[model samples]
Target: MSHAHPELRTPPALPEGGLRVIPLGGLGEIGRNMTVFEHAGKLLIVDCGVLFPEEHQPGVDVILPDFTSIRDRLDDVVAIVLTHGHEDHIGGVPYLLRERRDIPLVGSRLTLAFIDAKLKEHRIKPVAREVKEGDELSLGPFDCEFLAVNHSIPDALAVAIRTAAGLVLHTGDFKMDQFPLDKRITDLRGFARLGEEGVDLFLTDSTNAEVPGFTTSEGELTPAIDTVFRTAPKRVIVSSFASHVHRIQQVLDAAHLHGRKVAFVGRSMVRNMGIARDLGYLNVPKGLVVDMKVLEKLPADKIAVICTGSQGEPMAALSRMANRDHVIRIEEGDTVLLASSLIPGNENAIYRIINELTRWGANVVHKGNAKVHVSGHASAGELVYCYNIVKPRNVMPVHGEWRHLRSNGDLAVRTGVDPSRVILAEDGVVVDLVGGRAKITGKVPAGNVYVDGQTVGGATEGTLKDRRTLAEEGVITVVAIVDADTGQLAETPDFLARGFVSEEATFDAVVPLIEKALARAAEEGVGSAIQLEQLIARAVGSWANRTYRRSPMIIPVVIDA
Candidate 1:
């Protein structure tokens, strides 16, 4: 546990001096984001989040930050700040706040509100403070101000964190939306003000840095959705991110124009609508917002259902509906609008759900067919424009793939930010600030912690590699009988297998071969508990490779030993 922020020039550990930016996640990959800003004796964290790995990850549900590096100095962590209401920005609030219950959570009104709900979901209400444009706060050694920014979600903010070295402007998931539903442009003037104030470090969004041109506006999605629903013959069902109030509003407005009463289907949809309605962010007619249970009885043409689970999440309403397991089913003429992009690693699941929905006689509309979803990240030109406006002394792109980060480093260099200050870091790398100059400092104990439904454990790079190999090679469980005296094996091994049967109907054939292979080992006997287990596991693995054409994860269980 040394340096924190991902620094490309980092040593294996921190240099033990100066200001350091330690990022726990959101460097090598996209989610489970945690970043540390340490200067003097004070520390600040930006956006603790978790990543939801693809299905190939046996039982993991959400992935969170590895807090080993900063756990001892938890009290030094003055604030856990938020950038937006997106899952990757706010999902880890409850988990982190549960441990550091006294720490203050700060963010914009909407962002804070969303975090409040998330914390409540875990039965934890964090101490909260609101962040808005033009408000400044000094906590310990950190001075902070918020700038309003436009993204897919409302009330997205970029933080200009002030330190003795200078300001670190963090562009929190922003895009230049000229005609947004909020109708607020990306706050370039705020960044310009920071530039005037002298920002020493700039941690900007790299999600779209590799993509050319400006990002598409949320407003552009209107006419496309308008056309699709207008021409549709039956009810329109839309699914997207819960924080995407703009998208939800678009669907609602389109439904309103088409003489349909919107029925919110998922828990998140209902909850977000309530939040939006309470805050005057969504203007739903009194009777338009019917609950899912009530909407189930309505005619196909009269009600439009908006839900979550556009990415084929099994628990999502769309997934359940596709499988005919939802309270309401899509009939032959119903239209299902997948109002979200397919996250990488979820393509197959999404397509499977879409195909299922199609087979169930419903029409599934994606990006090509309907004006459904658009990205909320800024493109290359916008990032360049932001750099020019901020004119920071240092630039380290945050958020996105490696290509995006590298592209941004090149872009900032081209925009006159100086190549020496361009820091490209992977996860856990730290950038140290010395004599007002920022450079790659070191590394830290930062990585993803694999979380099961109820169990949380640290996951290493090796875990993923093993999971991939096992997924491809299959698995074998060997049940062997061992004698308690002298820890000896007593009889032939019993075997079972699942994934790698060349003939699914004849999978039972695997057991005979494995039994014959391990019978010799058992006859030879085991000296110790470890020996028995290893012997059975090795025999099962060998038998699996020879007969099944692939190595199975050999699980050896000895009975009566």
Candidate 2:
């Protein structure tokens, strides 16, 4: 079989070995997540996802989990089961499936269709078996069940996998959305059955674990948006994740209530809305919905634009409009309703866009002023509710930061789970199940992989360190030429500085500082290309603080002649 036809060969019977659960990513960090469960030689994966790019990464799509650890075990992966269509849960699928082609994908109709769309974008068809609530499948050695759960999107599942050792409950992104726009609820009976039947481990969503109570439903935001659209004196622009059909539904409904035609901009926003509408995940009265191009042809005040990039991505529809690059720009008197929360790290970006809109005389809507976006993950109270329902022998928190995970672990213990049973797992740490008992088995190298355009590479923590340094100092580039043979200075060093100073008058302060840097490098003389480069780098970087207010990225480019 070609390496491309990645087959997770599942042998029918569970071999006589203990079950092993390992978290590759999404353990200590927020995204680029993967969870692996191996019993004997059979392997099952849950939620292959990616992290959104940070500020430093200009052209990267999403940071993904490093698959090297599981690459060789590709044949052992019986099935890759997804819980929903969130990028943090399914973003890595296309990249993962591109390499391991034979693994049968499993998810609900909506999720599968979304994955299919993404895979199609990559020009790869991942073989997926449609799954739904109460559906069960026996793959190789693992018995898998998908239980419908409510979230920001439809077809979210709280999966229960029964292995030879015991059952592992993997809850993908979820919250107790009793009055969800989708009217979907977690299968309480199924959860109770798992409790009675006995569950060995519970791997739950901790994205909102730190919050106080039950997650707010998407339905709750409809009235707020309705009021915004209904009363707004001008045009309306809304932003959110493209996959949130429930959120999109609210936006559409509000548009109708306001007597405005809704137009969706952004390629992702367009594609996903089309999929959801076609699949019945969303309903739009025939003539009420249209494209941005069509909406542009009408009076701006008569239309409402729903677009992607609520996070303030530079090229996203919102960002493009902010910079006057989008085909349709929000003008004065336009109410830019930021109907989505700025995800933690994305606050600055979101605010940056908000500032742009406000600069252009558009009114911005946010939590500080009004209700827009509600979370989909259960808060503290709902998590406690889940704890009471599952009553697992062991609980391992997934899908949150270190503090949130630790907090959830504490909550689990407070809810009657043993402190010993509430394991704080880091990326790559494995917990072994033996004779129906579980304990930390070992650890592995699990980290994040950042995808820059077509090249996918592991995201180095050094970048974070650099960012921290840049915050305190700034970035400086020193471009210099060096002779390959004598290691002699070929020319005066050229210095480029940014984020460290003010006007042209202030910027020149770095030039002299760089000149002294060259003198130090010239005095040292070159031994090898390596030593020369280091000398110039150290001298220029060392003087950054005394001259400039901040220490900038010192790029000492040593061109060998």
Candidate 3:
């Protein structure tokens, strides 16, 4: 494939002997983190994931990475390694497993459990292997070690894979939270040990590279959540990401301390919390966790509910509750706490839900108003700290947008890594490691595979364009019944319009113009139904554009009797 940017010189095929590091996704983007590490002829895939669609991708449920590069080489793949259980990190497993189910999956116990549950929904039973921190595994030509890392989710890990080329360290979405709720600080000591062994290339999370200071610890939110529970006048509802076990733990602790019974809302919240409690990741006091059905019997002051939709997803529990369409209505004097960071591009929707909740007589609290949420990714200062500790010969920033990756590259240079040693790569750009040197070799077929409903890659660019057209300009349908021999209209054409104009007034006026076009086509000796339909379409389209200054989708349904 040709280089998208000319400066990124393309090298020859896979260098027969060197290790090739190709990121299929999670470069110049926030989600769908996947990387391919190939040594000799064997491949090791790290973090097959998905990206949530933005507003522009209408009707899309999720965006998966294009795995065309590896689809044909499934036989050489050793295993699929997962850093954590976040949807963006593990959501693509089912898609990949459908191609080849024999490939083994390696991750922490909880991570495997999460992936197993996700796979069960797809009716796939994958080969899963659970590994803990400090456990090492040898697969093909690579030696893998898992190091515990602090992130929003429990059991997150940073991987160190040693190959013939060199040791490649990938820090998967980590923050150096010294006082993490689980007491599993991002293994700075282990990272230092790896640095002593000499890390050839370092791949770090750049999600918060634009932010200057170190991210606040998860422990900081405990006091704030306690305050909310202490002063709440009625039932307290907390919203956060379903994968945020630490945030949910804080909510649970506060509820237990305030003598309130907790109920889990949202499908994901209920399922994930149940998994966490079963796996001993979440601690719930006896009889403190009540079912949602028991909420009505409990007094308002004695109840606490934790739900999903901190990002203001339209169909999520929080949004439905805010819109007064949920089974659990927001009553007067209720407190709704948004205990998750406001992801970029979601401010408008999130604030709208907040406004609705406030209008419904509930007090809303979020990071803007109180310290209820903290980022799970490391900031610039923390990145600098990691660079000084890891001391890699080369650096590649991943898991962020273009600006974030560039900022992270700058941080790496500031840490004394030569500018040339920093690899600022985009998705699909292959970086090869040969003789301890990293360079952009070539590119691959890395793009987005949009998931709309149950269909993957069904919504193409043209489909999205048509959907936008219909949304903006509406559509028109002309149904004409004609005699088989004459190829002429048997009756006046039936006209229908939607989203374009009012059917009663505007459509009635346009019907005559369509009929006239049909008559003109018949007089011109247009004998075929296809020709007549085309004539009607062209005429109606021109008239509608001239009259309304808008061109809607015009459909001509010719029925020949």
Candidate 4:
């Protein structure tokens, strides 16, 4: 297999009738999925999405796919073809549209509705074209067809793009759920037909490639959820992704069957479920769904709440409830169900929430303890089945970490695909299709673009590193007042520390060191306040590292008084 290496050079110009594929994100990671396809001097984007900030990326709201590679060529873009409405697939659309609002968005009906609502919040008026299974459209030099695919959310699709160079199929996050709640299974027959037509390259979802068997069907969860509703002594609170209409449908059914009224909590949960109900994607029985205020008046056993924060986000509703900061408290006898798969790196936060809710006398149920969730991506068996069905000339794994991508590539190889035809490229690695082969040509500028509270691309890696330093080792500020003529210490260098050794006396030894450094700098002709500040910062940093084995954020203020 051709793998992306660190020494890969910048890609050369596209050859005549050749197609270039550059993934900005969602390779080597599970979120912020964006890809750029160029053919005939026109660009077709697929899945502009966002990655949620982890514990290390403090104060960041969401991370975006760095658009540096395509920023200069936004005018050549035809449309952004979204295969689904999951946040990992569509959350970055508004940010991308902010750059070029005229770029048309193409997706299924429900997918478009979800994005439309999201765009409304950004005050963007999108030019949207809704397409479903079997719909074919031509944009510039690329002909695209949509195929139905069953996922956790409704109206998910897989797209096929045809150009003069070759045909590329992108299976956006999907699983072959034989018994989907909506009775819609993955379109394997459509995939077979596409294979017959000759797929030059296939970009498959690799999120669950390491799992051994077929994913559990969504239909099987009904009984498990019903059992929870029947056995719980008090109100049951189910947490999931707000866009998971199918899972919410199961919760609503279980609540109705157990003679309970369901109320959608959390702003996103209420808004999305309202949209799903209005659009008929979510079936709500009359009188079974009630307002939060109305449900609050009912007895605890007669009420059920559906909210977000299944991933343990600190600001989410479920997290606030666990912290006792939300209006709905986790009381004794309450049953809490976390109905989602745990994203990697969030295990600690999820377990913390689980422990907190358990401490509050609530019986917390999650994927570890019950059949509350199933993955939305195809496992190894299903991927092998698709490999046999499509049998593309070249295979590229998308939407997974390195291990998952490697496993998916191995699965394709085991299914008889030549190992050399497997392209293992991460974000920014450029792959080109020419002469009926896909090869890693070079690389591009792909990095994290942070969103920090109404600001895009404002917070950088340096800022996050400083935040982590402050969060971990804390900050220490040193103020040095120097003599104007002699450059000597005017006052004993004052020290104030937070998250470090807080006692002022703790810096008594460092004060003499700062004075000595300032005097030495003066004798060496370092007269400027900036130079003095730098000297003081180094002195304090050195002292802290030597004394406490800590390298905190050191802020030095030098005043020539």
Candidate 5:
């Protein structure tokens, strides 16, 4: 496919010999990993991704990066380079494609396939250029070299962008696994060669910088998974991230070896596996895989299920099964293995599900209980190794929380990189690399845009606050009909309370207090609907706080008769 976009022929307005590196997201945070490389007014975007919502962001579907910086500069964008196919790295492509469709997407074959599958769901046919390891592409003044890297998923890449100023290396999410499942180890030699050529700045993944030693390889988990398959008394159900094709491949291998038929149990699990298998990234034995319905008829000891919800997502398959609400039930002698890392904030929900599975007479195993999981990011030692190999003049830690970034920076200093050369930045901070030096230049618009239901960037903080208030304190709505001019009460006020009062007796008791307050407000000669609403709201709010020791959201609706 042609990777060139001849339509973007406008000459860029170059900065004074400096290349601007703007982190739109994925700095001092876990996900939504996007960065903008601007040189001579030409922009190249790296990894348009999204962040999953937290508990506090009630009703939000997903959180996307604020793209205000590039909204007006869509014409200047040359191409978008994807480091991997993980949702956190490519989830925001649909949103970006909506803004501009002509921008060429550059990534590995499988990465482009994953992106194509994702965009198909949005009914978008994107212009993608598939590039493998060692491929070079030049967009405007920026020349990029795609280098192979070992990550949880296949076809992960680290990008080295050569600008007029210097070469900037961005090590996407990677770990130094000497014996990777695919035998495609991270290209250390490539990094070393780039270092010898003199790299100006290095952006590295810091997700596991707090970890001390090297991260274990995907190959290491095979034996442990084999033991699970060999020892499990009945059905083996494994939970993992759907994007982890290597883990899924291991699971399939184990199942096939044990003569167990495999069945995928989650939406994303089935979809991603199908895509991977079709694209030859995942190997599946014929007739070894069966449909979900066929799984029900198979003997318990002869079936293995790979599913999502390793983090205990409420709507996920494993969570539903744990709650006894799924079509497939967890029975006695069944084993459920969580072959994934526990995300930091999801411990409570994950443990709750584990406890529920145990209560249902099923054996549950996880990273806390077994050696079935390993992190995909490099640790402190591996970060030290990369820093030594690249030997960049400046190091910027990306793709981590604050503590991880700080720890990664500290490791770089310990690796003989000068402390002055370590540049610490958060999202939206502009780091300019020029004259063989890197420094924070300025800031830009950076924050999360919440996706709620069908709306993107529609859920504001105020909307979330209202949802939280309604969830915690309930709502009390009072409807009153009054005279148009005089604001005199035409009838008695009607009160409706939801979640605040469960019993009719409690509601009846509160009605008299609300009535007395309304009567007093009418007697006080309220003149306007707004004035009466404020009066009744204050009265009802005070009564609820004093009498019930509660503060429900009091809403007053006045109608003119």
Candidate 6:
């Protein structure tokens, strides 16, 4: 199998009748899924999404797929095709639409509804075209067919794109759940039909490719969740992704069966579940769901709460509850059910919340402890089955980390796919399908565009480095008054430190080093305040590193006396 090379250069012009695939994100990571397809000088985008910030990305809200390569070609974009409504698959829609407000969005009915509601909050009305399974739409030069696929969320789809170059099938996040709560299993029949018709290239979900066997069915979690609601002595708090309609449906059924009222917490959970109910995606037992205020009035044993932050996001509802900062406190004997799989890069944060909730006397139940959650992507066995059914001429693994991608490629090869035809790509790596062959041709500018508060792409690596320094080593400020005639110290340097040294006397040893550096600068006839400040900063930084084995941020102020 061929893998992407880090030394790739800018791709040459697309071959005649060729389809160019450029993945801006979701290649080597778990979220921020997006891909740009160019054929006949028009672009068809698939899955504009966002990546949640990790612990190292301080103060960042979300990360978007860098649109630098396609910024100048927004006019060529025919539509943004979303396969599902999961945040990683659709959260970046509003941001992308902000660039071109008139860009049409095509997806299933529930998927469009979810995105439309989100867009309303951004004050942007979308031009949406809703499609269902067995629906086909002609977008520019690409003829697209949407097929039903079962996932954690309702109305998931896998799209097959037909162009002059060949047919490319993109299986957006999906799993073959034989006993899904909604009875919507992934369409292996459709895959077989496409295989009979000849799939030139297949872009499959690789999120669970590293896992050995088939994923556990969602139905298995019903009994587990019901048990939690039945046995809990107090309020049962179930946390999950806001878009996980099926899981919430099971929660509602369990609550109804156990004679308890359910209340949705978190703005997103309320909005999304409300949409799901109105759209008939989520079955709400009448009188079983109540307002948070109404549920609070009842005895704790009769109430069940559903909220977000299954991943332990610091500002999310569950995290706040764990920190005792939310209205719904984790009291003694309360049962907390984390009803989602742990996302990559979130192990530490999730464990911290689990520990905190346990400390607060809540019995924390998670995937590691019980059959409370399952992945939304197909495992290796299912992937191999699909590979045999589809039997595409070329295979490309999308939406996973490097290990998952490599493992997926290996699975395809083991299923008789040509080793050379398996394309292993990361974000920014360009692949072209020409003459029914897909290969990495070059690279593009696919970097993380961080969203900090109201600003997008404003946070840089340097900013994050400084934030880490401040959080880890702290900052020290040095103020020295210098004479006007000579850049000599007029007063002993005063040191103020934060997150570095607590006591003032702790920095006493560095004062003499600063004085000596100032004297050397004076003898060298350095009269500029900027130069003096630089000298003092360098001297103090060296002393701190040498004496305390700490390299904190140093701010030197030299005042002309």
Candidate 3 structure quality by residue, lDDT tens digits, 404-442:
999999999998998888999889998988888888877
lDDT of 1 by residue, 437-537 (tens): 78775677775688766767744557766787678876666676766654444665555665655454443554555455445555676345566677667
User: How close is every model to the real structure, measured as TM-score?
Assistant: 0.90, 0.87, 0.92, 0.99, 0.92, 0.98
- Candidate 6 TM-score versus the reference: 0.98
The CA lDDT of each predicted structure is 0.79, 0.79, 0.89, 0.94, 0.87, 0.93
lDDT of 4 at 516: 88
Candidate 1 total steric clashes? 10
- When sorted by lDDT, best at the front, the candidate numbers are 4, 6, 3, 5, 2, 1
Better of 1 and 4 by lDDT: 4
Q: In candidate 4, how many Å is residue 398 off?
A: 0.4
Error of 5 at 300 (Å): 0.9
Candidate 3 residues lying further than 4 Å off, grouped into runs, are: 1-11, 480-492, 503-539, 559-561
TM-score of model 4 vs. true structure: 0.99
Best by lDDT: 4
Q: Candidate 6: lDDT over CA atoms?
A: 0.93
Please give the ranking of all candidate structures by TM-score, highest first, separated by commas: 4, 6, 3, 5, 1, 2
| 10 residues in a row with least lDDT, candidate 6 | 501-510
Candidate 3: clashing pairs of residues: 11-441
Residue 144 lDDT, candidate 2, scale 0-100: 92
Of the candidates shown, which would achieve the greatest TM-score relative to the real structure?
4
What lDDT, from 0 to 1, does candidate 2 have?
0.79
- Separately for all candidates shown, the number of backbone clashes (residues 3 or more apart, or on different chains) is 10, 10, 1, 0, 1, 0
Q: Model 2, range 300-372, lDDT digits (tens) per residue?
A: 6688888887888888999999988877767789998877776768889888888988999899888768988
Give the number of colliding residue pairs in candidate 5: 1
